[model samples]
Target: MAIDFGTCFTTAAVRVEQAGTAASGVVVTAVEIENSRYLPSLVCLDDDGRLLTGRAAVQLAAQRPERAESHPKRALLRQSAVLLDGGEVATAELAAAVLARAADEARAQRGGTEPVRTVLTHPADWSPGDLDRLVEAARLAGLDAPELLPEPVAAARFHAAEVQAEGDGPIAVYDLGGGTVDTAVLRREGSGFRAVAVAGDPDFGGRDLDQALFELLRDRALDLDPEPWQRLWGDRTPASAHQRSQLARELTLAKESLSSTGTVYLAVPGYPEPFVVQGGEYRAAVTPALTASIVLLERTVARAGLTPAELGAVVLCGAASRTPPVADLVAARLGRIPDLAADPKAAVALGALTDPPAPAGVDTGADAGEEAAQDAVSADGSRRWTVAHYPDEVDPELWF
Candidate 1:
């Protein structure tokens, strides 16, 4: 079994042999949760202290905000305890609850006592410490230490096998998930792939866009009445946190709807009139993140010692990449239309189940300098840390 524990959502898959035959191809089926494959990465406790996971947790957050903990993954790097319902909740504990929920769904789907080997995917540039915490979370979730896979590597593997992308050159992966934007370059090797370069912005992606929209709504709410605003979201009020969570939930739904329409009119509670926002306004709010993602893509290619023309293909991963503005930016900046897998969100988990490439044969005829650089990158992959930089010279306004 493989689980893609996304910041905003999670998915799991189990591999099975076709018709119980040894020679049959492995078929992967998605584990269903709340009658859907996508599970919201949310955790919350009720008034009586009952634990709620996934969509249920998200719903509870709107009604009982103080007890809800959303976006726990973002808290991984912080040292302070997160305030939840007057208590401090450890980041690992919240992550464990979310992961355990996924594991439970998978076990129910399988209906067997067979010991399952689980693979969990993480962001490409996650530090060794972060990886260790993920393993601990899995363990706390009642699962053994899971095999860890980098998100982009797993994505590239899926693209190579499913798309039959035929090329010896490196493939570029543009991963725009709920909480972050990651760009990675991968070259196929014997039975596996080598990462040439990887970079990401933890503050960028769909969640950022949601916040931008939420701010707009908040401003309108304040104008409508500071009293209602204070009652719903003031720091000193009991229902303030709950109201904030409810607003966030509403705006997230509105943000997703903007993809298909010119405007999203919201009938927010306590607001005398509906809030109307144009799609263009939302696009402008998120352009900085989109621009940052393009720059990261360019930086990855340059670090790989290759021009955009030298790239085999640009593969788009994650659900947020489906947004039209992101796709347009990739085409305009990279000068190539990106290829998306069958299901971008599920690709990483599915790819984790793929076989590694066979070891490559030594090439005596290979260019000496190129081989040395490749070897260096491979070595760096096993090291504890690596730093990448985005051009500080770029104007901030250009991002939007």
Candidate 2:
């Protein structure tokens, strides 16, 4: 099993035996439990070293008020702290505690065994040291460290399985999730695929859009209020001083509604009124940033000597798959966009555990399942997430 232990949200999936199957048969699947699937990448700690995860921990924070800490994941990403009953806590410890909780759930679901194999996903451009830290965190969570998977690569597998059923050149994955926007180009190989080139901006994506939305409502200039917004919005990047509050669920809900409907309505608790926003204005506010994102994708396509028309399929991942601007931009640039409504947040986790990357030079016209399972294996036995790049030298744009 592999988990997309995302910063804003987390999901897990596993390869298991097929229902009523002979020992000769098994099906690989990414599984999800009700509400158990994603806990706001948050954790709260107590003096006794008790840890909490998922919705329980989130709720516990409100009750305990002192010992229970929240947003451990955010703390780590933002280099900030939360005042809990037990005193100050580090963000890394928070993430570790969350992972610890996730591991507990994973164990229970998998029959309480440590032999379960797991893969952990990370930003494609994470410093190697950063990956090691995550591995160590997983260890702290009570399981053996899991294999590392890149968010883009997991998304590539999910997307290729969907669109490659019809046609193939290269599969372009635009993964805009709750936390980051990532994009990558994969060429199909005989069995699996390989990333020719990849790029993403850790600082951009849905989280960035959240900041833009907050700025729209806060009535403050980006320069003057940027610090506060950064604390709330840019939690994925390195920063100092963070506010531990979570986004008002209603605000994020309203912002999400604006993605599809022409207008969105929101409530601010302290205000006596609800706020309404027209989608057009929202798009306008974020256009310049998105334009650069499109160009970032174009750069990778151009480098590959393949026109957008030559693309196999554009796969979208992350919670931001619903953002109209991101979808429109992909269509405007790539000529086609794959359907992404299925748990847009968990698609990568699902596919990473079940769907393998398209074979290099794949013919987008065929169904993936029709091909033998043996076809999913790459010559090197590495998933596309094992991107081979001279990270020290290559500085491609950080969005797919």
Candidate 3:
């Protein structure tokens, strides 16, 4: 089993070996949780002080925002604990809850048989200390010291095996996730890939794009009638909070709808009419951020001692990479059309499972010795585990 615990959603995949047949091969399939392949990466504290995950957490969060921590991975980077509902919850504990949920669901799919090997993907720029915390989280979740893999390396592996781009040059991965954008350049060694360079902006991601659209909505709302908008912003009542949450969800749906259609309508709280937003307006609003991401991709390639033209392929990972402007910007800046994974959200998890397994009789524990041993393998051999260690359209009111 392989897990990609992401900022906005969690994905897991299981590797099935086909045996006793002439066409024996390995097939990787995404694990479905709660009837959905993408599990919400949310953790909420229940009335009993127990952590709830997936749809349960999301449902609870909608009613009580203070009791939920929406981004545990991001929280793990800054502080040891996060304050939720007037209590301090350990960040690692929050992360463990999500991991446990994924592992449990995956196990159920395998007829309650535990995975022989579990791999988790992380950012290439993560430090040793960060990896230690991740391993600790896995331990708390009852995982048997799973192997760790760098996210971009996994994406590159997927490209080499599945896409099979034409060239021996390195592959550039542009991962625009929910809360961050990571750029990496990786070269295939033998059966695996190694990261040559990585660069990213921790503060920039899909949420930033959402914020830009929200600002446009705010401006339009204020112009229509400042009184209701001010009331929604300042009121602390439960009803007001629920309305605010609904508006946020609606805004997100509108943003996604813009990717496929020209216009979408959004309903604002305390307003009788819906407002209109155009696809062009959203693209214009997010162009600067997309351009900046493309620039980072270029710089990462240069850091790898190669030019954009020298890259064999540029792969796009993460669900937000589905935004229409992202590909356009990449082509416009890099002079190459980026390859989008068949299911961008599950690429890393699937790729992690695709990695060559460790040689038999090797201790795959969360220990420095084992990690160092794995790192000693030849470039053509198995790669070292990076230790570880929807809105409907409506009549137009204001167009921004």
Which candidate number maximizes lDDT?
3
What tens-digit string does per-residue lDDT give for candidate 2 at 1-400? 6677776778776667656656645455544554455657756564576666666666655445455543444355556456666477655667777666555666667787664467777766665545555666666665564666677767777666655574656777777766656666777654455566677776777767777777676653333444554544444422211122333455567678887689876543334455566899888888788778767777777766678888877776788777768778777766776556477777777666655544556554455434322212233232223343323213232211
Question: Per-residue alpha-carbon lDDT of model 3 for 134-183, expressed as tens digits?
Answer: 87788889885577777776777777767653665678999988887878
Worst 10 residues of 3 by lDDT: 390-399
Please, what is the TM-score per model?
A: 0.82, 0.77, 0.88
Give the whole-model CA lDDT for all candidates, comma-separated.
0.73, 0.62, 0.79
Point out where model 1 deviates above 4 Å.
Answer: 19-23, 47-50, 165-168, 219-231, 235-243, 356-400
TM-score of 3: 0.88
What is candidate 1's lDDT per residue for 1-400, written digit by digit as tens?
Answer: 8889888888888877667587787777778899988888877877776667877787778777678767777775564357788878777778888788888888878786443567778887776666667766777777675666668777887887776545656789998899988788877654456677777776677787788888777787777787866666546454666666666767878887887788998776577788898888878877876888788888888877788888878999986777657777888898888897768888888887765332246342446324322311222122121222332221111100
TM-score of 1: 0.82
Error of 1 at 179 (Å): 1.6
The C-alpha local distance difference test score for the whole of candidate 3 amounts to 0.79
Q: Residue 140's C-alpha lDDT in candidate 3?
A: 86
- Which candidate would rank higher by TM-score, 2 or 3? 3
- Which 10 residues in a row give candidate 2 its minimum summed lDDT? 391-400
Error of 3 at 390 (Å): 36
